[model samples]
Target: MANVTFTSPRMQRDLTVYAVAGDTHTLLSVAKKNKVPLESDCENGECGSCLIQVSVLSGKAPVGMALTEKEKTVLRYAGKITQAQIDDAETNDRPPPWRLACQFIVRHEDILVTF
Candidate 1:
């Protein structure tokens, strides 16, 4: 299982939810299921409206995962992540902080997501 903590200062509340590990569901799907108010236009990975900063709360690495090729492309185009950051992530074995919620899959890691 994975614990997902979502925080929005503008909303004045924080939400915590659980998800099955290794599911095909993306973070945006989980948020929608739980009624978390995440702004998203295109649920696909093309739009940057669902972009959020992901932080691993309990894991060996901050991101604890690598970006998917689609995520890399969308995030790079949205200017949420840079090529230099991608190179650094490759060298350091961690994902970039910013990610598209539509593309981020929950693994067996606890994550704190901020938007």
Candidate 2:
């Protein structure tokens, strides 16, 4: 299991939930299930409204999670990530801090999500 903590000024307090590692569920689904108040539109990866900042909290290297092509385009257009960041993520397995919640798959590592 991995601990996913959601934090935002829109919420009264931080909320943390457990998620099964390697599950097909996206972070947006998890947020909906837990009522994390994460704003989203177009559940698909086409919209960038579900953008979030994810930070690994396990005090270790973050697990590599693949970014979908749609996610790359949307994030790039939003200026959330750069070409170099994308290249690094693709080549070095280093994910950029910004991600689309609808495309992010939780790995077996604790993480803090800020929206």
Candidate 3:
């Protein structure tokens, strides 16, 4: 298991990372573990409601794979995240391919900031 870090006004500190971690677990888990005050309107990845800037710090991000049509569009307009910045599993639409925090997954180390 790898360590996941989240830094922001509400939360700061790294927590144990797990695959398939839901939105509530993503923030609530981090907050509970790190003693932070983070809130989630919806647990699911939608509304862009829990949008945050996830600054991943791992060079091992799975990339080079083809992207879905939706992913292609998001990759085109990515601000800090690019198509090359995503991993293969993270490319799937189920958990979301990236763009929103409530969606994207962080396999590598991260310094996520809440916006």
Q: Top model by lDDT, which number? A: 2
TM-score of each: 0.86, 0.98, 0.42
- In candidate 3, what are the lDDT values of residues 5-36, reduced to their tens digit? 55555435434344333232454445445554
Order by lDDT, highest first: 2, 1, 3
* After superposition, candidate 1 runs with Cα above 4 Å error: 62-66, 90-92
lDDT tens readout by residue for model 1, 1-37: 9899999975668999999988999999999999999
On a 0 to 100 scale, what is the lDDT of residue 21 in model 1? 80
Clashes of 3: 0
TM-score of model 3 (CA atoms):
0.42
For candidate 1, list the clashing residue pairs, or say none: none
Which scores greater on lDDT, model 2 or model 3? 2
For each of the candidates, the C-alpha root-mean-square deviation to the true structure, in angstroms, is 1.9, 0.6, 6.6
**Which candidate has the top score in TM-score?**
2
